[model samples]
Target: MKTKRFSLRTLLLTAVLTVVLTAGVLLGAAWLLLGRAGVSMAETMVLINTLFVGEHDIQTATDQALDSLITGLGDRWSYYMDADSYQQQIQRRSNSYVGIGVTVTYLEEGVLHIEAVTAGGPAETAGLQAGEEITAVDGTALTAENISEATSLIQGEEGTQVTLTVRGTDGTEREVTVTRSQIDESPAEGELLSDGTGLVTIRNFNSRCAEDAIAAVDSLVEQGAQRLVFDVRNNGGGYVSELTDLLDHLLPEGTIFRQRSNFGWETTVTSDAQCVELPMAVLVNGNTYSAAEFFAAQLQEMDWGVIVGEPTFGKGFSQQTFPLASGGAVNLSTARYFTGEGVSLIGTGLTLDQEVALTEEQAAALSAGTLDPSEDPQLQAAIELLRETEEPS
Candidate 1:
């Protein structure tokens, strides 16, 4: 006799389980937000009533709940674009969205920090600068949940207008009116270092990034680059395929990674023929994540090179995009990935061989030329790693 097919109840339980484990919400508003699609509060209470009967089976009920909810939405990207997805999107595209172009992030103080103002964009055109506090957008309080929504609200068709209520670093608050328009985001930037080390900062990994990076590397190599410092600072991450193709040039032909799903199934992604075996150092910090971590992990795993600076942001889950009838998508973590050496960088990030920390004052000092990159602990450590492994010219 064969086993019976999974029921809708089972599907909903699976979804609930996935959401609870992934988001770690046990109850209250967070739980309501997570399971609002299908499982009503009453239904949840009913399931809780059965907790005693379903001991080990509680997980099945939760997963099934989540499955039912997800199936109803029918969206692929609309489910929840977690931090990892946000990082990937930012680093994958060079084309800036149309809006009062400003990079805003939540700081430790719970205030919206004006991280960057793209030059020539509406925000900069309206005199918006970095280090300002965005208090509100059209009078709505700015919060982490609404940050993306506010940005989207500001972005509109070309020739649109947006008013921002911002408080400067001096605690002065005011409203500024600005028109929205297209802003360009550059992907690949390269500079020649003093020691003939080509320093390339690939801000994103969009389409054609592999070619762009190769060209940049070739230009640096031609410029007498004996070593390379690939700076991915503040880089969130992007296309896994793009990163894999890039690693093809940086890692030897072999299994680079493995992806395991909820069902305990595994798939391996291997490297291509071409590989770069130069003296290289990858710079990562608390923000270097997703595909960035992927590159760093494999490089460190194979002992091909060194990963310096600080621990990575550690986003090891893989999302599968499913399209919805509403022209939206739901991108959920369908699988977890590991390095060739079985290192998990999920909640735990990549451990750099050399650890370094930076103070605000030190960063300012470095920016003002009082400190040097060669003297910066992180850079110095990376240089030392590269020098120690250098090949005789």
Candidate 2:
């Protein structure tokens, strides 16, 4: 009866082992397909438990194994997220965060510059205004190199208070304390320049980004925008749906996006007939990525606009989030994307029609959101090209 019980226990362990497979791939396929690889993850796991050195939890070992496997794929854009981290990532993608009611940018002066104060939010209540620099947060001096650290210093549980040292544009400094709250902020914004050119800056392509970008452009036209400049500098891309939708808003009837997956699947997204038809340009920088780079490429390729600034740091892969049986997920690069012209942007990013480099001071001011439109060389270059493109009216 003891021998019978051992055999039953082994069968149960082998059955349970298959649960460790993620995306319904990897180990199970390894066990069945090589005609098998990993020499049976079950056998490996059982051996680790019975003979491996040191303390190890089976669940943790499984998680690490999956993590390592994904990391081994050598795609910097892909990775595994544990359940808690995955939830946090989802919250970030939703474009909401717990913070004082202010939007900030890291200046080259090693401080955070207040770009916009949310009306009636904690920061505004504490008298924080746009153009002020956050010199320090909770006594830790803010720095461009550690923007994330400074951001974390200021954010806390809702109703918690954080102290900040702020400097106004005039150089006057003061310390203020403000309570934090949940803030839903979209970084996409539009402003009509003094010369009637609409300036739309999209910092991210997440959440309601498509809606926000479309609205910004339409509102600018309503305000008598004679031309348009889209600033996507420092933009790291987000959802594909958002990118395509925004492209549809700006580009006339044509293919806006093309993609191919590992399984030999291909697809394309086309825009409608209606589109914004103003003289336009897309401002980009090296930090521009993924959908942002593609946005500029499509415009330049279709003769709708010119690209200004340094070439984009190209991204050819599109990722898909695959949930693991482990309750976490892996963001795997599942598809290769191409420009609207069916050109890949992997090694060669979008070529700039005008390669405008920022001066040290100009870059600092740009980061602080304090750079005047009249003072930005890249914007000026784009405006010049657009002026040449303007029809006699």
Candidate 3:
């Protein structure tokens, strides 16, 4: 009876081992099949290696490898973006992201500076001031580059909450919580001053920018504004079509700007609409780039407006995005644009008609909310030029 019990136990052990081996083989075969059936080789190998080596988590290892590889490419501008990041960038390009609608800039010292607050945006409503330094975003350190990335990340679906840490010019850090909202991002906002002058600020050339600009100009005209100041400071850029429409309303019947590709002088945009024949001034600065520069250069070439402020940002290269199968895209510079007078503004930016320099005290005073550029001496200079050019009809 004891011999029979030992034999039975041996038989049971053999059956258990056989089942385990069979299951292992089946799993290996399934993995191989998946590899053959269009699974990413890197992902498949990572899984298999993890199973065999029993070292690291497969997903973590894969992400780390990808991050390392992308960073090792030695291009600071090139980065590995996940699905959320990719979606956010696409939304920003399409002008549909929900944020506080504050344009930001990075100073040379890695400080995240607020450039402008869009009218009717959450930032404007929150009373965020320009020249304010962002100290942190949701506990993340706010370096210039990190702040830019964080801003994009903080901007989410409508009604989301974004906690920001701000350090004002007074050097005091405070926490500010802002709820994201969909604000009307009209590219232009204008009104007639008491002196019959149009005070217009061009935000960006988005989808409805030109229409908004025309409406602003028309409203100012109805309000008896005879002179115009087109503010394009801190304007990044947007739709080329919208820019064309804007120039058409401001420029005479002639070539506005020229685009040169490898094919050599591919296309020239012209003004089809009647010009708004008024004494105009285009405001530009170092932050003004791309479509803003295009508009400024067009007006400058046609002698339609006097450009005031600092030299424009020399970003004349045009980029186009191509989607990839992995749900990501590449923004590659494909062509270069030039002014209507055949001047390349890529490396050499457009010079201003008047160079306005602010003293350190003036800059500090502006940061402290003491000085407003709308009432600035520089802007007053532009308005005074309009006053001098005012002729009785």
Top TM-score: which candidate number? 2
| Candidate topping lDDT | 2
Once superposed on the true structure, which residue ranges of model 3 sit more than 4 Å away at CA? Answer: 1-82, 106-149, 165-174, 359-374
By the TM-score metric, which is better: model 2 or model 3? 2
Give, for candidate 1, the lowest lDDT window spanning 10 residues.
Answer: 75-84
Per-prediction TM-score, please? 0.70, 0.76, 0.71
Model 3 Cα RMSD, 1 decimal: 11.5
- Model 2 TM: 0.76
Q: Residues 84-173, candidate 1, lDDT per residue (tens digit)?
A: 344335433645555677777675443567777766778888998777887777777777666645555665677878778888878899
- Which window of 10 residues has the lowest lDDT sum in candidate 2? 33-42
Model 1: residue 196 alpha-carbon error in angstroms: 1.2
**Poorest 10 consecutive residues by lDDT, candidate 3:** 362-371
- For candidate 3, the lDDT comes to 0.73
lDDT of 2 by residue, 145-225 (tens): 777567668767998989999998899999999998887877588999989999999988889989998899999999999
For every candidate in turn, the CA RMSD to the true structure comes to: 11.8, 6.8, 11.5
